[model samples]
Target: MERTGTMKTSKKMMHCFLWVLALSLIPSAFNGCGGGGGGGTSDAPKQSNNSEITVSSNQINFGSLVANQTADNSFTIQNTGTRNLVIGQISTSGAPFEIVAGSDHCSNRTLLPNQSGTIIVRFTPTANAVYTGSFVIPSNDPDESSLTVNLSGVGQGLNVTINRVDSSVPGNIRMIVSVTDANGDAVANLPNTAFTVFEEGEHKPTIVVSNADVHPVSAVLALDNSGSFWASRLEVQNSAKTFLDQLRNSDEVAVIKFAQVIQLAADFTQLTSAAEINNLKAAIDAPYTDSINATLLFDAVYNSVDRLILRNPNNRLAIIVVTDGQDYDASTLLPGSTHTLDEVIAHAQQAGVFIFTIGLGADMHTAVARRMANETGGEYLYPPTPAGLNAIYTKISQILINQYEITFNTTKLVGTLNNLHVIVDDGTMQGDDAISVTY
Candidate 1:
């Protein structure tokens, strides 16, 4: 009987231990289908399950972009799972650079498992400001609910300016060129730096460029309308036209015509059109019928120089006088309105106005004309006949081509008359370095 009772108890104990083992195994089986494995969770992101998409680069970077220029870049999105991955939203940080629309920005786009599509990116910069931003892509997958793209860029500024200099000693005009880089800093070691001067539509030669600081220039053209000059007016007209043709687009030109009353044919206008200059030449050649008895030569010179005093307070001034050189009667200038011939010479010297005199004949007050020319640091030329006038015109044209303007900083001037000397360093001129210092 006792042995039978022992057997029953043993069986009951075995059953109890078996029940505990089964409970532990049940938990292990549930864990295998629950959250322990890579793809166990129902909402877990998985490339193999087609629930997640992969981007080649989470951030796009554009190093540097220049002002008024553009730059571009792109990336790709791939699906590595069996399910479709849909990107529901894309957001970007709104500072610095901007987000330009790309193919991925299109609505309702989906990537199939094991297939790939593109997410193009673009950055546009405005002004010279530095910028940085990011783009975020949100999706249904829990692992990659948000994909962030980083961006950065910079803009460089540009610079521009106009520089003028005085090549004129007493009262002349000259310009300087000093172009700057994008940073407003002057470019170093620039080649072929030059400034052009113009009046109306006429082109003057390039002004000699030395330093970009202050350039020096002194120039003037005086015209003769004396009765004797009338005979060669056509030649004079041609000479004037040729001279105007050689003018640079930036230089200043003053036209003077003298007989009794000195007339300013033109003043300080840019030469932009040939027609305008031709019109001026026609007007200059128009007939003047008064008797040859009144050539107020000294008065004209004085007037031209005096006018320059107002035009430029500190630049060296020059006068080109076209005349017959006959001091027939003179003295038409009102008292206090002008100076005597000697006084005009002295004033020109004091003011540093160089006078270049063109005489119509050696028979018509040649001595006086030559003297005036010499006193004012100028030359006197006699044309004699109409054909001679044309030759004279050619010679004068050559001289004008050789002319340049010097501009000095007014801050360097004492406002008193100062001596000016020009030295050209062109080695090709052989031994002829002695430049005629006009003014």
Candidate 2:
């Protein structure tokens, strides 16, 4: 009996041990089955080494150097990666700036993990300038496909910015310009002796710098009061008043309101007078009350330019035409303007008038208006809504008010394309501008 009992106990102990061992081996078998053998998607990330790029600085100032006098500067690029980084071409823009060949170790080279390279730059300029430009760095960095580094350098002082070029008169070419020094400050109080003018590369002997910043301006304001502006009337009038208040005392401004018929709301007058400004506001605020629903945009622009020409041709003339849509007067049921778009542009060009156009909404005839502005040396602005017209008017007024007009006598034949180059020397520092105009 004792032997049988001991045999039963041994059998039970062996069975229990086998069952526990099998349970432990079951997990190992499941683990052994997962060795990247699936054809489906895996949620794990790639284990490949990724190349990274880090720059020491994004800006390089080469300081001031002489004209054609070359200076050297450099920036460092480091690779914070686990793999090799291959860099591509490095390109730069703006004049007198270039990359020094055989000296750039960062471009067209392989940078190993934790390695650094250098980008060498050369500033060999032709004229004195306060130059600002940038260069692009392309690499095999996963996070950064490319990077732009800003670069600035100064060469002596002369860098001319041409504000605009105009044909103010039949025999004269007018130029508006401003000069900046090496420090980028406007150099003021320059004289006629400070400027040298050239037409078609031939030096002109008669260069008179007249119409200083305080010079008077003659401008006409053309506001759209058509069917398109029915919803925007109050906003339009408010913006027009804002423009009227900003003009200088010497500006001869006219207010022209046009719907189906163009009306000279207020004739040419100076905004410097309180009564003149009030008159312009009142004219702008007057009700149309007519059932005519058409826009004579082209005619308004044409008549405004004509009014400016009739006022005084010597002063700077500009026409600010604000509209929301195309001209619909020709097809209207009411009497309207008869001038064409091409004729208006031609007249403005011949009169040397700048037509600054403001397109109010998305449906505005901006393409045609832009052409009028571009051909007449004016600007076209599209304010998303009418409320933003104040800022645009402020910009236009400032530009027209504080301009220095330099008139040069040119013997070039009419309708000939003439390229004019001007260099204005502010005694010590100088700047230059290049312009092409058919006169």
Instruction: Report the number of backbone clashes for model 2.
Output: 1
| C-alpha lDDT values of all predictions | 0.55, 0.75
Model 2 deviation from the true structure expressed as Cα RMSD, one decimal place: 18.3
- Model 2, 1-439: lDDT tens per residue? 9999999999999999999999888766765687643334355566558998889888888765545556667678988888899999888985678887787888888999999998778887666668888889999998888989888877766545444566646777777665544432345556779888888889988777864555577888888888778788898888888887777777777888888777878888777789878888898898865544787778788888777777655577788888764877546454355877789888987776878788786677656776777567676667778788777787676556545677877777778898888877666665566657777
Top candidate, metric TM-score:
2
TM-scores of the candidates are 0.42, 0.54
RMSD of each: 30.3, 18.3
> Which lDDT tens digits does candidate 1 get at residues 1-439?
8999999999999999999999868867877777575333656654355377687886676754434444556667776656777876666787454445655642256767766766556666656667788877777656887777788876544211112234345444443322322322333332232333332223334434444322123345677676656666677767766766655444456776766566777665545677666665665565554444356677778877777766554443557677766554444533322457788877776566666677765457666676676566555666656566555555544443433333433322334333322222122210001112222
- Candidate 2's C-alpha runs over 4 A off are 1-173, 176-197, 203-211, 329-337, 409-417, 421-439
Best by lDDT: 2
